[model samples]
Target: MEKREVVVSITDNGPGISEDIQSRIFDPFFTTKPIGKGTGLGMSISYQIVTEVHNGSIQCISQPNQGTTFNIKLPQKYNRVIPQ
Candidate 1:
C-alpha cells in the first residue's frame, strides 16, 4: 500500500526461510528461532489481527542469504489511528 493506501511491513536479514517452510510461517507456534528466542505466535496473531480484525492483508517476501520483507495493505480510510 502507498499514497492513499495503508501499508505495514516487517523486514529481516536473517537466514531466509526455505520455500518448503514458507507456507507454515504464519501458523501458530511455528518458529525457526531457538527455544528462548521466541514463542512463534507473533506472526500468526499479527496476521489474524490485520485480516480478520481490521480487514487488512499481510504478506512476506524473502530470499535466501539476502533478507525478508512483510507487507500489509489496508484502506487509508480504515486507518483508525491516522484519522484520514
Candidate 2:
C-alpha cells in the first residue's frame, strides 16, 4: 500500500523563538514562561500524541524577530494492534 500523510502548519507573527530554546521545546517541564505561569508540558504532550499515538511527526521552525511555525505531519492511515 502507498503511504500518505496529512500535513498541518501553525504560524505566529509574534517574535520567534531562539535556537537555544527551540531544541528543548518538546522536553517535559521545559518552558520559557515565568514561574507559576506555565507548566511546559503542552508541547511535550503534543509531541507524544502526534509521534507515538498517531505515528506522525512534529517540527518547529523559527528565527529571532521573524516568526514561528509548527509543522505536523500525520500518516493518513495507521495500523493498531488489539490484544485480547
Best by lDDT: 2
**CA lDDT, every model vs. true structure:** 0.84, 0.95
lDDT, candidate 2, equals 0.95
Lowest summed lDDT across 10 adjacent residues in model 1 is found at 75-84
Write the residue-wise lDDT of candidate 2 on 8-84 in tens digits. Answer: 99999989999999999999999999999999999999999999999999999999999999999999764654687
Q: Return the number of clashes found in candidate 1.
A: 0
Clashes of 2: 0
Worst 10 residues of 2 by lDDT: 75-84
- Point out where model 1 deviates above 4 Å: 1-4, 35-37, 78-84
Task: Give the clash count for each candidate.
Answer: 0, 0
lDDT of 1 by residue, 1-84 (tens): 554667878799998877767788989999989999999999899889988987888988887897888899975774457655
How far residue 55's Cα lies from its native spot in candidate 1, in Å, is 0.6
